[model samples]
Target: MGFIIKLLLTGAAAMLAAYVLPGVSIDGFLTALILALVLAVLNAIVRPILVFLTIPVTILTLGLFLLVINAVIILLADYLIAGFAVDGFIWALLFSLVLSVITAILDMIF
Candidate 1:
């Protein structure tokens, strides 16, 4: 199914991103898959509420605040998932950005 394929791509991207960034680490592909699922759930449930609440700041920053929200989601994932860790906020931000890029490329290819 398309959803399963996307999840697999996200897991692959997470693995690649963790490999590329010293500050990010994943135990294995299984853990990467778990991470991908957790991220998707958080993005679906938590992200919209955060975005709505932060609209004023988001507008003031010209949408840059979304990056912070993304990092927060990553940090939350780090907290919720075992075998996955991000060193700090900066690392979370970088990891999120790298993961996005890798996922986009994978999506394009597949």
Candidate 2:
């Protein structure tokens, strides 16, 4: 299914992020897959609500607050997933940004 494909792509992106970012790490392929699934669920259920609630700040920051939201989601995932780790807030932000770029590229290529 399309969802499965996206999930796999996201897992791949997570692994890619681990490789490219020093402060981000995934323990294994399975952990990456799990992280990807959790991230998808959180983004679907939590991210929209956060975005809606932060609209004022988002507008004030010219939409940059969305990146912070993405980082928060990543940090939440890091907290929930034992095998996934982000060094700190800065690493979370960079990881989120890199993961987005990697996933977008994967989406395009696949």
Candidate 3:
């Protein structure tokens, strides 16, 4: 199914990002898949609420604050998932950015 393919792509991107970033690490492919799923769920549920609450700051920052929100979501995933570790907030921010770029590339290719 298309959904399954998308998840696999996301997992691959997560693994690749972790491999590229020393500050982030994922145990294995399965953990990457789980991480992808958790991120999707968090983005679906928590992200909107966060965006809504942070509207003023987001507006003030000209939408750049979304990057911080993305990093916070990554940190939340780090806390919720085992076998996945991000060294710090800066690492989380970098990882989120890398993951987004990798995922975008993968999506384009597939």
Candidate 4:
């Protein structure tokens, strides 16, 4: 139940990012929900492997590189889905950060 709420909140955050950032585009609520699910799965699945693979870079960058990884994951999701487009790498990174913060806040509030 809580996980479902989180997904909805995350989708709302993604939609919000699309509104805030010109480079990020979401079709609508349904599309946003799908994108949110993809992002969550990516963060859970691919993210761990990525963290392990990029451990050296993560260490070198003092964990800042994780932001880049987050962006990449978002971009990958955008590419995988229709009507969900992230324009640039940096834009993706910013969008990722905003969505993450929103989800965290929502999690706390709920």
Instruction: Report, for all candidates in order, the number of backbone clashes.
Output: 0, 0, 0, 0
Candidate 2 weakest lDDT stretch, 10 residues: 99-108
Residue 94 of model 4 has an lDDT of 90
- TM-scores for every predicted model: 0.99, 0.97, 0.98, 0.95
lDDT by residue for model 1 (1-110), tens: 99999999999999999999999999999999999999999999999999999999999999999999999999999999999999999999999999999999999999
* Candidate with the greatest TM-score versus the true structure: 1
Q: Which 10-residue span in candidate 3 carries the lowest summed lDDT?
A: 1-10
Which of candidates 1 and 3 is the stronger one according to lDDT?
1
lDDT against the true structure, per candidate, is 0.98, 0.95, 0.97, 0.90
Superposition error at 103 for model 1 (Å): 0.5
Candidate 3: segments with Cα more than 4 A from true spot: none
Error of 2 at 91 (Å): 0.7
lDDT per residue for candidate 4 within 1-110, as digits (tens), equals: 87888889988888887899898889999999999898888989999999999999999999999999999998899889998998899999999888888878877887
lDDT of 2: 0.95
